[model samples]
Target: MRDAFVRALLREMARDERIVLVTGDLGFGVLRPVKEQFPDRLLNAGIAEQSMVGLAAGLAATGRKVVVYSIGNFPTLRPLEQIRNDCAYHGADVKIVCVGGGFVYGSLGMSHHATEDMAVLRAIPGVTCFTPGDPAETEAVVPAMFQTPGTCYLRLGRGNEPHAHEEPVPDWRFPKAIRLREGRDIALLSAGGILVELKRAAEKLAEAGVSAEVVSFPCLKPLDREAVLSLAGRFTDLITVEEHTILGGFGGAVCEVIAEAGCPCRVHRLGLKDEFSAVVGNQAYLRHLYGIDGEAIAEKAMALINEKRTDAGRNP
Candidate 1:
């Protein structure tokens, strides 16, 4: 996914001379091509995250489109004040790109985990939050952020993530939830690289005689409310899954939509609880530990399905 993001970013930079790539001395392996092609446009901020963001804001103020890239909390939580004040408050055309969201850096411990970035960034006014599900979604999101005229946040996974979309999305735009599969028993929604696990859970649910619909949410802020409401009205059970904490994350966004519309679906949010990760493990293991893994998703869906059955039996 990081490879695809860099490729798309390089493509955007090629045409737009105003676009600049600034980093906190990270992503050397993935950003090598970017540095080679646009030698003058790239800036190595050298681990100074706050200054890197502030510099991007100043550059954007001078009519340059800036993209600040770093892993996890380095470009976000570390430089939040600059982002909220310089970028978001000013409505600067600065794209804050974060790689290794959620537990992608779990082995490095909670400090490297970007579990709160989406909520933190989204809280700022005028900042767009994007969490792409796959390489194709990443490709779609970069161009959209470039065209958008204010601060934007791009939350990315590690790399080598399988393509979730079976085919290309035609005329895709930001803040629109993409429906991957359709079913009536329950609806499953996911964001970022977590979509893969949701898809797996959908298959598992199918084997267990439960039909599930899958939707991928790439854009969290300015969420596709109509899409969310459409599914909520159609399905009795709607479950939102994400790599970040359930509070104020993708699930929170979906719940807001459902609540506003008064949709009939009973919503279940699956994500990390309100605590730091204590165990050191890989991404998959961490997700399971939080009970937000693929099988966990299936279990949550089955519980909801059983509840509906029990209610019907009692009423009948």
Candidate 2:
């Protein structure tokens, strides 16, 4: 995913000379190729996330397409006040690119975990949030951020991430959800790194003769109301998965839609609990510990389906 991010940025840089990449001195392996490709356009701000955001805002004020890149919590949580006041408040044309969202740096502890980033940033007006499912989607979405105006937050994970796209890359559009599978029984909605986990769970459910539809939401801020309603109307059950806490994450956004529209479906949310995670092994192990893995997800989905089935029988 990191390589794809670099490649996508390089492609955008080749086309747009106005694009400038700013970092906080942590993207050594990821930004090396970007620095080599666009020497004059890349800047390392050295451990100052607030200053980096301010600098990016200043650069954007000059009509330059600015991208501030750093680890997730550092970029999104640490400099949040600066981002909210400098970028989102002023409506800067700055793209905030965050790597290692959610539990990507799990072994590094909860301070590095970016569980509340989406919910926090989404609350800000005019700020766009995107979580690419895989390398191909990351490659497509990173470059498209340049075209969007105002503040755009692109959440990326660590290297060697899974590949969700089996075929060619789809069209790039921020604040939109992509339908990966179609089914009437259930709808599995996911965003960020959780999409990969949900995909595996869907595969296992398929093997158990369960037809589950999956929706990969690259964009979470705008919350695709049309898509949510359409899927909710078709499917009898809906499950939302994310790497963030159950509070105010992707599932919360979907629940808002269901309530407002009076849509009928049993929604099950899969994510971290309200408590902060302990210092664990790594991202993968931490996810499993929290019951966010494929097996756990499969179990939850199957249980929900059976519960719905029994309820219907009792009512009938």
Q: Pick the candidate with the highest TM-score.
A: 1
What lDDT tens digits, residue by residue, belong to model 1 across residues 1-316? Answer: 8998999999999989999999899997899998889999999999899989999999999999999999999999999999999999999999999999889988888888889888888899999988889888888888888998999999999888677887766678777999888898999998888888888899999999999999998898888888898998898778999888888988888888888888777788898889888789988889898988889999999999998899999999
Model 1 TM-score, all chains together = 0.97
| Per-model lDDT | 0.89, 0.85
lDDT of 2 by residue, 56-104 (tens): 9999999898989888689888899888999989899889888888899
**Which pairs of residues collide in model 1?**
none
Any runs in candidate 1 off by more than 4 Å, and if so which? none
Error of 2 at 274 (Å): 0.8
